[model samples]
Target: MKKFFYILLVFTVLSSCSEYQKVLKSEDIATKFKMGEELYNEGKFAKANRLFAQIVPNYRGKPQAEKLMYLYSNSFYEMGDYYVAGYQFERFASSYPNSEKQEEASFLSAKSYSMLSPAYTKDQKQTVEAIEKLQTFINVFPESKYVADANTLVQELDFKLENKAYSIAKQYNLISDYEASIKSFNNFIFDFPGSSLREKALFYRLDSAYKLAMNSVERKKEARLNQAKEFYESFKKAYVNSEFISQADDMAVELNGALENYSTKS
Candidate 1:
């Protein structure tokens, strides 16, 4: 009985495919639209897209154009071709500015771009684009139901950028490039004033300055040590009870002792 049922199912599928192929090659536009909508409703988006793509130009400026364009764009999204989905949805929204589907189309367009955001360690061009698109969506649709989701994606992308910058700065410290590390951390602090990594950035900046001072020539040593001492003081004031306080205190003592020894030698 099961074998009989399996054979019946296979036959039905083949029959449907045969009819679908016939529709694909037919010159009957209305039949194609109907079959495409049915295929889409059945989650057969690739086949539906093929049908829709054929008739879309023929139906342009007709009563069904807007709906056809929306479905066509969504087919790309459903297929996970996000770049094409983003472009197609953006086109639909612009082509039908007052469409009832406009808000959804715009949101999906930005969401598609967000899907293209690569890892935090990669080049951030797509991440920047995603943030800009999400921000634009929020500004245009302040009360949108998708606002919270859009905001979350923006925050995630922003943190990715922050982490990328922070990692690059920290790499300089790891490689003993004290001068570049100090400059990078300073720029990081200025750029991401509210970063959760601010304390760490400050700590590393102080460490870099100290290392740079210790390695400098006698004439430059005093000036660099003074700068390192200032960094230590600032860090202490900002993080009085921090876990790093003890380590920072040790660095301070080293800076002061070095300065005194240098002065004695002079």
Candidate 2:
């Protein structure tokens, strides 16, 4: 009985494949469209995608165009070809503004870009793009059912961008590029004021200033030391109970001592 059932299933699958091949090669657009939708509903996205591709051009300007394009873009998304899906969905959004699927297509287009965003260690161009796209979706469809999900995606992408910027600024400090590190960290703090990394960025900025003062030429030491002291004051004011408070205070003692020494000399 088991063997008989297995054979029957194989026969069924083979018969379906045969008919699908015939559909693929058929000149009739209507047949192709129907088969493509059926394949899509069956989760046979690759096959559905092929069928849709063949008839897409013919359906343009026809009543079926909008839905066909949406299904085509979604087929690529379901198959994990998100780069192509993002472009295709974006095209659908612009081409079919009156479509009932407009909000969904717009959201999916942004979500597809989010899929392309890499780890925080990588270049963040895609991450930035994802944030922008998701924000645009929110702005356009304020009450959309997908608004919450889109907002969540934007938050995640924003954090990734913040992490990348923080890492780059920290790297500058590690490489003894104190001047650049100070500038980078300052800019980072200004750009991402609400970032969880703000405390660390502030501490690092002052630390970098301290290091710069220590390494400065005799003519520049006093000025750099004064700048470091100002940075220490800012850190103390903002992060009074921070994990870095003790270390920052130690740096401050050294900065003030150095400043006093310079004062006595001048």
Candidate 3:
């Protein structure tokens, strides 16, 4: 029984060594790259990236150069490595500007940046760059098949950038920098009129005006209060059921009560 066990162990070791040596041998790269495409089509992105990376540098300036770069870029995209993928895609676009894949490459490069975009509360360099690149794609390939999707992504990222600016402007109000707060909010509203943040921007606008009105609450600041009223009314007209409606209404009542008391004293 011990001798039989020894024989089984020897066979297992030999089998393992043989398989490892086989893996060490260089594969038929074209066949492997094709297999990678198959796996990529199957959503096996990791394996596809490995195969693609293996081929591109070695196949430089070959017919497969452009194709491998494109496939490699796509692999990064499929694996959700947006930043690297974005760069890879951009490289492909620039390298093969007249290639058949130009439209798709340009669009995908911008798409990669869009995917890398952080939330509304984060840095927006990627968001801004994405917009520029996407618009370039739109301009260059107005009739491309990817136009609609590219436009949609650009719109979405622009909204995020608008929201980020809007929120930062509100922060100034929260900390009582009324002048800067108003400026920030106004900039957000004016620059991105097509933003889906329309109602939200208007709401924050009213809030800024309200905060400005409170700058001198006890010193008969009727002018500021009147400005607040205008903004509040605008907010009400646009977003009647706004969550801030009650607070706005309360401000209105308080201002009216103050005016009435002043009249009584006079």
Best by TM-score: 2
**Model 3 score (lDDT):** 0.80
List the pairs of residues colliding in candidate 3. none
lDDT of 1 by residue, 1-266 (tens): 99999999999999999999999999999999999999999999999999999999899899999999999999999999999999999999999999999999999999999999999899999999999999999999999999999999998998998898889889999999999999999999999989888899889999999999989988799999999999999899988988888998998998999999878987
lDDT of 2 by residue, 102-146 (tens): 899999999999999999998888898889888989999999999
At residue 218, what lDDT does model 2 achieve? 92
Expressed as tens digits, the lDDT of each residue in 29-135 for candidate 3 is: 77667776776788878877877777677788898788788888988988889889889988998889889987788888888888878898988988898899889
List lDDT for all candidates, in order.
0.94, 0.94, 0.80
Regions more than 4 Å wrong, model 1: 262-266
Per-model clash counts, in order, read: 0, 0, 0
Cα displacement (angstroms), candidate 3, residue 75, comes to 1.8
Q: In candidate 1, how many Å is residue 98 off?
A: 0.9
Q: Could you tell me which residue pairs clash in candidate 2? A: none
Q: What's the ranking of the predictions by TM-score, best on top?
A: 2, 1, 3
TM value for model 1: 0.94
Error of 3 at 250 (Å): 4.4
